[model samples]
Target: MWELFLTGVDAVMSVQIMILIVLGVAVGIVFGAVPGLTAVMAIALCLPLTYALGPAAGLSLLVALFVGATSGALISAILLKIPGTPSSVATTFDGGPMMEKGEGVKALGAGVVFSFLGTIASIIALMTIAPLLAKVALRFGPHEYFAIAVFSLTLIATLSTGSMVKGLFAGTLGFAFATVGIAPVDAIRRFTFDEPNLNSGFDMLVVLIGIFAISEVIKVAESVRSGKNAAIGSVSMKSIKGFGFSMKEFFGQIPNATRSALIGIGIGILPGIGAGTSNIVSYIVAKKRSKYPEKFGTGVLDGVVASETANNAGIGGAMIPLLTLGIPGDAVTAILLGGFMIHGIQPGPMLFISQGALVYTIFVALIVSAVLMLLLEFYGLRIFIKLLAVPKHILLPIILVLCVVGAFGLSSRVFDVWTILLFGLIGYGFVKGGIPPAPFIIGFILGPMAETNLRRGLMLSDGNFVGFLTNPISGAFLLLAVLSVAWHVVGSLRARKNASTELAQA
Candidate 1:
């Protein structure tokens, strides 16, 4: 193992490979920091480019892109209150608040540093326990998957944090939207409305851009119309130094970072679920475990650390299933699977025996890419701060144009652009109604997974719904889902009662 590892290190240490890693990380950061553009899109665009390069160099480039893109999401989430990707949604909760408090540097630095640490932790786990983890993942059948989705959906309550009723409404609405396309099993069109465009349903990217980016543009426009300066807060480069926090502060986040990284890795190992879920789940876990949970969304480094660490750690966890079982963990890894096939390399148990050196080389590249991402983002911190100084009126228009371009770029269809516009209006309405967008996004993403698995589980059991309860794993997850929803409901009621009692006393 050591000899093969050294051979892998030697392969990636070449100047060409190193340069590609750096270049890929830079490009990925640009993609991830931009609204509507994502790491998946970045990898898809670059997929064909790798056809000419050697497998090691090409795969390494993709790895760097994945790492950089996952971490880069913090930039926009903190600075603009727009998440660059779905995975960074939770980052906005505290990161935006931190930026508002002039702690933008601290938020950005914590995000960057924790992201690197998370990736490193996951890589170590992948290298040491991939096969074992893959074996466990194989035990998950449709029943288990359906149960997992149910549990994940229940998290909508936790995500609401403001109004559980509004959160449930938004999540249910998202599930309804997800059902607009043809049924996964029956292939029957439900809500196409005789329009070809609706057949494919709404693209997740379009929804995300509409909810976060276009709505933000509308808000800024409203401010401009009212003759009030768009207040994004002030950022001074002079006030920021050395990642904007003391060493003691970094050490304090170690526990949160470790836990978040573990959550990321666990989520990544599960097929289909990705960093999008992990980051949110980790944030919730951190908030629940913190002694000062009330300070979570009010500009805390702990929130930033939890979100960034888990999402980036998910990159390594995602690789475990992809390499060991020939199964893609998420959309990004699905594209990576295509990259492997293009290179005539089939990834599975035999892959290690057939290409041990190449496997180790990829691992080495991932670790090196993590370090490079940290260094690059750290040095470029000042430049990112300057972005806050850009006039909102001018900066927002550029962002609006990019949003349009990104919408169109999804499938090169004008329909998607319209989708973005429509969702933007809906998102604006949601905001007015006090409905949280996080649960909606989560519901939309997980609805199909839940439905598909449920249907498949039923079919496998010959329509026996009892199997869901009979399987230990499935039963356990379902019970947890019930407990999670109940816990939130009780908490909400208690808080409401307390507020009413206080008001009456006053």
Candidate 2:
């Protein structure tokens, strides 16, 4: 192992590999910091360019981009109160609040630092116990996957702020929209309305950009119409040092960061599920475990730590299954699997033996990219904050244009542009109606996973509904989901009872 490590270090230390790593990280950060662009989009666009490069160099570049893009999400999540990527959704909950409190620098610093830690943690896992974990992941059947999806969907209740009914409604609406595409197994179209564009269903990017970016633009337009100042409030950066956080505070968050990283890794090891889910789940777990749960969305560092750490850690977690089992863990890794195939490389149990040097090169490149991400984000924090100085009227229009371009670029379909517009209006309506958007996003992502797996699981069990409960892993998760609902119901009843008692006494 030491010899292979040294071989990898030697291969990746070449100037060509080093340069590609730097370039990829830089470009990835740009993509991740911008709304409407994602690491998947970045990798997809740049994938063709890698054909000219060697397998090791090309994989290095892609891995670097993956690392930087994942970490870069925190910038927009903090500065603009919008998640630049789906993985950063939970970051906006606390990061937006921190920015409002003039602690934008602190939020960015914590995000960057914890992101580095999370990536490093996962890298260590990949290096040491990847095969072991991959074997464990293989035990997850369709039943287990459905259970996991259902369990994750239940977390939307935790994300709901005020009205559970509205939250569930938003979640159900998102699931309904997901159903617009073709049915998974039967291949029968449901809600396409004879439009060719609807056959493929709504793209996640379109939905995200519409709900977050376009809706934000509309909200700002409303403020401008009302003659309210359309500028983001100024944030102070003076006298800030070393990631804008204290060592004491850093030490305090070690447990939270560790737990979040573990969650990210676990989620990433599962095929189909990705950091997009892990970040939000981590935030919920952090809040549940927090001594100050009430402060989660109110500009707390713990929330940022939980979110950033988990999402970035997923990079390594996603890689574990991809490399050891030839299974792509998430959408980004699925694309990465293509990159490997394009280079005439196949990943599986034999990959480590057949391409040990290249594998180590990837490991080295990941470490280098992580370090670069930390350095670049730290230096770039000032530049990111400068965007806050741009008047919202001016800045928002540029963002709006980017969102349109991004939506149109997905498949070059004008219908997607229209889809974004429609969803944008719907999102704006959601704001006006006191509905939370997070639950909707959760439902949109998890509902399909649950549905597809439920169908498959039932088929595998000869249409027996009891099959899901017979599997220990699936049964455990389902029980947890039920317990979660029951706990919340009991809590609500107690709260109403207490309120009634107070009213009677008065």
In terms of TM-score, the best-performing candidate is 1
For candidate 2, write residues 1-506 as lDDT tens digits: 78888998998899999999988987788768766567865675566567678998999999988998898878888877878788899999999999888788899889999999999999998998765654565567789878977765664544355566787788788788989879999999999989888887887657766776677678768866455433343456678888899999999999999999999998877654678889999999999999999988999999999999999999999898678756555557756776786688977656777887788889989999999999987786566445434455666677677667767765677887888789889889999999877667657766777899999999999999899998999999899878876777788889999999999999
Error of 1 at 340 (Å): 12
TM-score of 2: 0.64
User: TM-score of every model?
Assistant: 0.65, 0.64
User: In candidate 1, what are the lDDT values of residues 265-345, reduced to their tens digit?
Assistant: 998877546798899999999999999999999999999999999999899898986787565556577557757866889
Of candidate 1, the 10-residue stretch with the lowest lDDT total is 225-234
Every model: Cα RMSD to truth: 7.0, 7.0
Worst 10 residues of 2 by lDDT: 225-234
Which regions in candidate 1 have their CA more than 4 angstroms from the true location? Answer: 1-115, 122-132, 224-366, 504-506
Evaluate residue 277 in candidate 2 and report its C-alpha lDDT on the 0 to 100 scale: 88
lDDT of 2: 0.81
Clashing pairs in 1: none
